[model samples]
Target: MLLFSRNLDKLFFRTLEKQLALTYATSTEPQREEEFRVLNLKHVKGQVAPRRPLKKIVPPPPRTQQMAENQDWGNVWPGPRSFHPATVPLPVRQGYVEKGVSPGKFGNAELMKIPNFLHLTPPVIKRQCEALKKFCTPWPKSLDSEEKCERHFPVEVSSSDYCHSSPTIRDPLARIVSVKVKLEALKLDARARDKFLRLVGDRYDEESDTVTIVADRCPLKKQNYDYAMYLITAVYHESWNVEPWEELKSEADMEYYIWENNASKVNVEKIFGKEAKDIPQIEVYSSAVDKYMNEGESDHTVEQYGQAVRKILNLPSLGA
Candidate 1:
């Protein structure tokens, strides 16, 4: 029974080894066929899509060459913008010369980079004015004369406007408001005039008697304008007010020499005695002092002052 079992086991092993060799031969035959098929592909060329013909580029006609002399300028440029050479009809040129000739308008970067005011032609301005005429009110008949205009509009408000192609349209000086009015327009008395002058300081023009107030600290023009008007109103009202301390001011504290002051009046009274009012050259003396103090000192002013002084003191002239 043991020998029979051993012989059966040997037969089983032999059958298994033969089946393994057959399986290996079958797998290797398919792999060898795949390798031969891949090697054959190397000789074959790859297929490509057909190429299309390129279209020719046609250049545009020069706008300047096509434009006529009778063409409307307003139509060409309706508003302010960056310069464009092609749109402009003029034979304009820019760029520095390499030899004797400058670069023409066709491809001029310099011409296109800068600002242009071509839209603001005379004809265009006339047309714009005509269109805006309906919105504008007629000039007042009462303000026909310059004096009447000044009288009616006592305060003249001045401001500027700037236009450019930039990140901001606003200019620093554009917001500044300058208000001017004649000193006489305010109808201030001597005391008020002095106070107003003091309040305004150097802004008051003594020669022209015009007070000019400039407001620029504010951000907006309207705000500056309002501030200027408020300042003018405040100064005007304050000038009219009489402070108790102002009454204590003596001749020495006065800004300019006054004939009505204690020193001048007393001296004149003492010199002329009872006829102080009838003193000769009193008006001339006052005028001389005013000119010397307010107007300016000069050879003529000094001579006038000396003459007035000598006359007031009753000193004999060199001719006498």
Candidate 2:
């Protein structure tokens, strides 16, 4: 009787489950139970399907193995894609192993994870360039040489674009913008040039004749570029500007010596009288003094100044 009751209960649940098509996993929503027999069965197991024979899975031979010896790799790897050992003919291996050689490419997770540029082979690159040539504009015939390019595009604004894996979307270096222009390109006079040099300090490359300003204070690349340009403009205009106190600057207060304004010129004029400016030796003395003062005292400059002074005074060389 007990066995019969259990069987009847089981049959009732099976019938109810089939009718409702509900499982304990699917009873996410609240459902009120009716009295006694209609109560929610906490352990309502579903009917299992009959077991069947399993079929085996077999992989085909590698594509590389079947490919001809002289097959075109360009066709095989048409574009960039994930690495497949079966497709690649090379015996690529990766992973660290102590005793044995590195694991073959067959199941190399490292190989699959890293980027591959098989599609960007020389032949493929040449083909791509040839195809793209039609879309590109021809080079300007006017700006043929590098010097001409520099003259035309004086402001060489440089910035970088990055494509890398990091926590942040934008790279710190990408935000930095460097503005480069030739010092001569600004067309600054002596006073303005001195002021500009003082303003830029080490940022000015004397060897290259370029003034470089790096702007990274702003967060965005465009803002930094704008800031760099603003700096260049400001320095240029400020150098040209003369303050009220500039007139008060005496020979002693000057940053660099002017050959025309110095006491040396007045002394030479006193010695030669009215004909000081007319003398050919006076010009040589002026050049030597100008170079010595502006370029700083050196052996070559000292020798030049000494020779010029002797020439001006009509002094004869003494035998050693």
Candidate whose lDDT is highest: 2
lDDT of 2 by residue, 5-104 (tens): 9999999999998867666546876777886766546645664578988989898888988999878888999987789999999999989999999999
> lDDT for each of the candidates?
0.85, 0.87
> Candidate 1: misplaced stretches above 4 Å?
1-51, 141-145, 263-282, 290-301, 308-320
C-alpha RMSD in Å of predicted model 1 compared with the true structure: 9.2
TM-score of each: 0.73, 0.68
> Which residues of candidate 2, in runs, are more than 4 Å off?
1-54, 66-82, 165-169, 269-287, 294-301, 307-320
Global CA lDDT computed for model 2: 0.87
The TM-score leader among the candidates is 1
lDDT of 2 at 73: 81
How many residue pairs in model 1 have overlapping backbones? 0
Candidate 1 residue lDDT tens string, 1-320: 99999999999999999999999989888553433434656545674568898999998987877888898989889998877877887778889986987888878888877777889999999999999999999987877898888888888899999875678888887999999989999998898998999999999997987999999999999999999999999999999999899999886788776665547567777867854568887878777877877668899899888988888778987568
lDDT of 1 at 105: 81
